[model samples]
Target: MKKIIGVDLGGTTTKFAILNEAGEIEQKWSISTDIEREGINIVPNIIDSINQQLSQSGLSSTDVLGIGMGSPGSVDIDKGTVIGAYNLNWKTLQQVKEQIEAGTSIPFYIDNDANVAALGEQWKGAGEGNANVVFITLGTGVGGGVVAEGKLVHGAGTAGEIGHMNVDPNGYECTCGNVGCLETVASATGVVHLAQDYAEGYAGDSELKGLIDQKQEITAKIVFDQAKKRDPLAKKVVDKFSFYLGLACGNIANILSPNAIVIGGGVSAAGDVLVDGVREYFEKYAFPPVKTSTEIKLAQLGNDAGVIGAGSLVKMSR
Candidate 1:
């Protein structure tokens, strides 16, 4: 019973999982991402952790198919190098393959975290093995990945960056040096910012307004909740967020014509309220053929998507 090893390396924590040949996760665990010493500890920590886990479980490189990993940055799959992930204090990481494969004696594969999450969903979540899928993650910011004909598209390394998709030329400035990116309006922080911007100078009777006036911490989830409770102000904000999200998805669908566009990340916890709102606008903006063919879906894997997707990378490569 050979297994696959998946590693989802994040800025704060790294997740690990063992999955059987059939794509079922057997055991999963985590380790804090040690960004100290220029992220030099990251690879060594991973190597040590995987080796220990395998040893304890009576497994070894022979029992494992491969190790797949998802990390944040521009990853050169061919070179096995990571370039400049500042959040992780990694200006540049070289010899990733040399370190991991040498340490573990197992072949290693890596990709951008967003792309790996998309692959994970396609394999075991909302995508359900769809030949073509678009995965959008709306967290503090937006992230996306594209799978075309059952293959992850890795064009120039950063191909599926939906968050940076320019939505407005004069809108809010994005961290990516763009004005009015999809992430500026569709991410959780984006949603909250939209709520605040809309709340200014409004003579409306609403719970959302009350929270804003009191300087309460208003999260994207709160806005969605208020919208569900029929709060007019919150409804307005959510409507705007959904419009931008749907418009983005609609355009992507027109270009890629994927089987489904799946939404994930923390903001997705808003669930049906978020999906329904996006769907309404997506239908209106999508091309006729795409509107009917490409389904909008919510990601089912949640926190596990990254690790699972990373595992799928090994299984897929085989």
Candidate 2:
């Protein structure tokens, strides 16, 4: 009957789940993330929802052991402080955690969202049973998490940032104020950018061209579908993007030497087309022993990884 609360805070939504000590979800809910307000303001909404759910279940806040939150910023884990969350406009992690704790007496634990997702995957998803693993999330923006030596590598809260690594130094500008970051070429948005660049000079007839009108709604999904149908231009775009992604994975492997690389996010739905291309390219780009040693697999946790990982914070902290 023991329970814990897991909070996954994102730019659009804040997902919460009540999990038993044995890892079963008792209830789940969500609220708008309120990007316009300061990060601290969202805390009361979260607490209120948790309390409502607990009351509906004939329980109380005291029945829960603690709360864990996955945030989108650098965190000082030891201090329970958020060092910087420019996107959330939060000045510190400690302030956000304290605000949430102030709403209740339970202990709170927080970490970067991607890192937490990695832990979630390791605990119950694709990375299960693997002590060393790399998790890459390919969404509007790319994010990553690393597990090494049976532990999540924090490296002072800045560790698993494969997205910001320089992949194409002269290619595109990223929101992180970097030029040619891996995220610029390997994320869902990155794929769209590559598709647009390819569509401009594409002469071959294809269904993709007809799908989007004058506005160039070129999305990653369409490009993936076209690639699935063997469209040459779409295939080229995917390959180009995949090559950079493979190279980035290889680099991460070389440094971390993880047992597996788990890729998540919407774009991963492309399945084998994405996996094979990344693996093939990794063989060509990766360092000697690194390429041969690591196992590359798609993440299995999907949307639940964030909250699931949040739920397992107690394990990660130890």
The candidate that achieves the highest lDDT relative to the unseen native structure: 1
The TM-score obtained by model 2 is 0.89
Clashes of each: 0, 4
Report lDDT per candidate: 0.92, 0.82
Q: Report each candidate's C-alpha RMSD, comma-separated, in the order given.
A: 1.3, 2.6
Over all chains combined, what TM-score does candidate 1 have? 0.97
**Candidate 1 per-residue C-alpha lDDT over 219-281 given as tens digits, one digit per residue, 9 for 90 to 100:** 999999999999999999999998889889899999999999999999999999999999999
Lowest lDDT 10-mer window, candidate 1?
A: 89-98
lDDT of 1 at 211: 96
What local lDDT does model 2 show for residue 66? 83
